[model samples]
Target: MNRFEYADNKFSEIEMMIAIPSFIIGVGILSLPQALASATTAMDGVFSILIAGGIVTFITWAIAKFAASFPDTTFISYASLIVSKPVAILLTFLFAIVFFSITAYQVRKIADISKQYLFDQTPVEVISLTFFLVIIYAVSGSRVGIIRLNMMFFPFILFIAIIVVIFNLNWFKFSNFLPVFQSNINDYLTGVNKSLFSFGGFGILWFYMAYVNKPNKAPKMAALGTGFPIALYALIFLACIGVYGESVTASMLYPTVELAKMVEIPGGILERFESIFFVIWIMAIFNTTAMAFDITVLAINLVFHHIPKIKIIFLLSPLIYAIAMYPQNLIEVSAFETFLNYAVFYYSIFVLVLLFVVAKIRGVKPSE
Candidate 1:
């Protein structure tokens, strides 16, 4: 068998479909309304999401095509094939750091949200540690297990989103979305940049595409995976704008969660809908963090080659925890998240373009 080809039958294309959207719809959703509102006014924010999502879709397609051409080998492996080992190692290692930083962002953001909304009495460290422990357990298992978890939790996440939008319709005002494109060119650019982070999770495609059972259809599946989130995000952003108005949405901390709080069932049985929303939303975060955590370990193993994955998982947990705890307040967390958003956006484009150019120059091709 070729070094890059494996007969592992763990993940089907359907699971690939499940996994990508799960990663895309994570902690970012909570703040998307604010991010959008801050960038532009009214429905212009919705347009920003659509534009950003389209750009990310193209990026996903490029990554999918690149990965499928190299079958069963991740960026870490094939990058080394296309480029020199030292350069590949450096680039792949930087990608690993990007993924790890994402995991840490999720860890801290979820903990802060949970403490503010769910467990006010509990220490944030305790909450974050508990979440990290769950993530560690999930990633420590087979990669297929993480995909299965995504498949299981995605429906609840989707259902809650629909419910929030449905219940909040009473507050919707058509006038709120008026004056689209009123923002200056710079403002639209700012909004697009803000919206870019929401789509960053698609970068996982570079690593996960290697596991697809059918490589030929992988690009289509990858496109589908990314396309759905674009639609879903547009719907949620529109719902938030029509309900909250741009100014109010911008002022709010977590506009989507606030949208949930605005919901009222006819019977009033569910008092704290945002709390319920948070619970399901955490599953999305878990899917993202677990996969990224797994990829981080995979990248390290590619470099070290001899270290056991389990030991690497154990070793990296503390570093993740430390990073998770590093943000002392919401201000610091916001600053850290802003820096990461730019890093993810720029690095994804940089690495993809570099690998594609190098692969072409070197006439890199898969084994027959």
Candidate 2:
């Protein structure tokens, strides 16, 4: 990752921009309403989501600007200049570990959900292995291919999400907002901390922005890309409370998917709407896993310079599988997810801020 080598597959700021939501909107959205419901009352979750989104957006913009400042250089390279090489290398390894952990978490989550909804008879291990295999194929390809995949899948994801929200209008009860803002600051703070992980994809900006054709435009476009999901999640939270009420939403596992279940086509053409939602949502999850695992590969490559990229993927595949299968039941799975949320919060927010402040104090300027 310290190498400044740029391949021919550099992308436009637009592509980089769209990749944000493509990464941010995956597995997190499926269960956010439930998490928010338990933490905040009524429509108050909307404020928590907005507040978390704002925090993520600001950090994404600033860190992207900082990463882009070094132009053509990887994050590790610039960090080594600001802090010593050994420290930068350690930081990169930790970054890679967090990404790897989240990748495993996403793999396990998809397998568990798919088994519940789509493949009741199939083993979770089988589903997770198959899913990770495809991600391996993706990571083995050109990096731009992953970004292009994000671009292709994002529109369908967003369109389906919006359709779910719009079709659920009949279920809305305006009285849901009657108890607005009833939650105290602690509730809002708790809710915001819980929801912030959904926007954690911003952490990818450090490595990804190094490939943007126009680094100067990185911050604005990154923020704009994230804006889409912030609105989408807040709206989905509102739709969940509106359609199902706060108590019911809190009781359910996947309220957003439930919203899809309630959508009836005008002509009765589309039955089992949640099926389509699951299919498209898998695409979103794929984007997340591929980008994250790719970064894991990049970070490992930085350490083992002589080893090939394909070998790294092969070496890590079994470890990810083991981690995915380690969670025996729902309670353990939830605990594992909470661990990831904290890992991501620390790396994405705290680590990025540390890098930014250190770079400034040391007066490390970007290459002209």
Candidate 3:
């Protein structure tokens, strides 16, 4: 790709397939077991994960179809045609805030976990600042650089997830998952709602599909990408339940992290696995943060075309840092995350549906 091509576009179907899952499976994975356990039984959580995954996949496909309809144009561009330019600008800024909010959540959560598991003596301010620096460096380069980072690190992410599951097999009890369907309709609804929110990151496809080499293939690639996190979440949920029981998993703050703590290497190859796990897991979180940051910059650039991306990234870093540090403690962090959960969910539906309906009404044809 030449400079012009690289500047204009940065993703292919395969890169997108890798990027979507990498974006989706970040800090949320750490708390997924607790989220699922709180709403339903161990077995019920497994079912809820699958159900929620399917729903999210369909929503993402819908967003992809909307993007495909306006090939070579981003949500920010087409939305202006559907609505007024000022309205699109306002909504774009609002959505950029949402993305920034998630990046904040990731940095805060990663810092919290690092303090608890890996750096008991280190200050969270120091850890978060360091992590933020890495995120800035990742986003400073082309979006293609970030996409390649995801593609390279994805396997390590999977390896750690599978290793966590495999190493916990000795503690697994079949009876822990017994008495399935113990929860009522309300319980299932609550569990599915929580699980469904974890898949919120897929909404990035709205902004990203415009860069796809084959925009026509984006829906299928995105659908397949969605499946990775679903299967990974289900397996992790099952593993947590089998090892810790539903009650225990629900009570614990980070059940998956705890699951890593439980692994006992026979030869004492590495005494502490959770630290190793967190090291790998933090990179996955970085992928999530960088993608969110990149989109926020992209959104801003859509309105102010003269600003360079590098400068925008530098200008936004402090605001993101401030947001990440705003939460005083874990309770406040959880409250913020819950707010983001519902916000992303409803906002995504509104944006996708509005675009699709307006496109049809306006006779916006899908490109050849």
By summed lDDT, which 10 consecutive residues of candidate 1 come out lowest?
1-10
lDDT of 2 by residue, 1-368 (tens): 44333366798999999999988988899999999999999999999999999998988888887788788888788889888799899888998999999899999999998998899899999999999999999998889889988889999998999999999998789897669889999999989988898888787887787788898988899999999999999999999999998999999998888899999988999978999999999999999999989989988887777999989999998998899899899999999999988888777677677777887899877767
Which candidate model has the greater lDDT, 2 or 3? 2
Across 81-190, the per-residue lDDT of candidate 1 in tens digits comes to 88878998998788789889988989999899888888989999999999999999878777777887888998888898898998889999999999877988888888
Q: After superposition, how far is residue 278 of candidate 3 from its true place, in Å?
A: 1.1
Using lDDT as the measure, name the better of candidate 1 and candidate 3: 3
Candidate 1, residue 318: how far the Cα is off, in Å: 0.7
- C-alpha TM-score for every candidate: 0.95, 0.96, 0.96
Q: Which 10 residues in a row give candidate 2 its minimum summed lDDT?
A: 1-10
What does the lDDT read for residue 36 in candidate 3? 87
Residue pairs in steric clash, candidate 2?
none
Better of 1 and 3 by TM-score: 3
